[model samples]
Target: DVKVTQSSRYLVKRTGEKVFLECVQDMDHENMFWYRQDPGLGLRLIYFSYDVKMKEKGDIPEGYSVSREKKERFSLILESASTNQTSMYLCASSLYGFNQPQHFGDGTRLSIL
Candidate 1:
């Protein structure tokens, strides 16, 4: 089975601090995504990489960036953590395309103080 692993299950950060969340997939999938899940907003994409060294901004990319230097790993960087950015961050992977169901890691719940 395909598997995605997130670096953290929970995180605590102070406002204005930089935060890094890592994700790794073992399936050699061509697509990886970072999304923040909130109470009523559901899952909002933050960034996605289709291939090594390639990335695309998703619905909510402000204050966030991503790195995809390797095929199996993707990293999400929060330039400055904020209270509003405190949410459950999820990492997902797929073979490619909307037709494929994305397999998600458990998730990282981040709290900003």
Candidate 2:
């Protein structure tokens, strides 16, 4: 089974602090994604990496950046945490395209004060 692990299950940050969320997958999948899930907004993509050192901006990428130096790992960096950025961040992995359903980690609920 494809497994994705998130660095934190919950996080609390100040309004302007920089935050990093890490994700690791054991499936050796070529595609990984970072998304923020909100109550009524569903899952909105933040960033995605198809290969090592390559990344694509998703629907919402403002104030956020990503790194993929290794195939099995991806990281989401929030340059400055804000109250609006306080949401459930989810990390997912897939074989490649939209055909395969993404396997998601437990998710990290971040709260900005």
TM-score of each: 0.97, 0.97
lDDT score for candidate 2 against the true structure? 0.96
Clashes of 2: 0
N/CA/C clash count, model 1:
0
Off by over 4 Å in 2: none
lDDT of 2 by residue, 1-113 (tens): 88899999999999999999999999999999999999899999999999999999999999999999999999999999999999999999999877989999999999999
**Candidate 1 least-lDDT 10 residues:** 94-103
Candidate 1 Cα RMSD after full superposition onto the native fold (Å): 0.8
For candidate 2, the C-alpha RMSD (Å) to the true structure equals 0.8
Model 1, span 1-113: residue lDDT tens: 98899999999999999999999999999999999999988999999999999999999999999999999999999999989999999999999777999999999999999
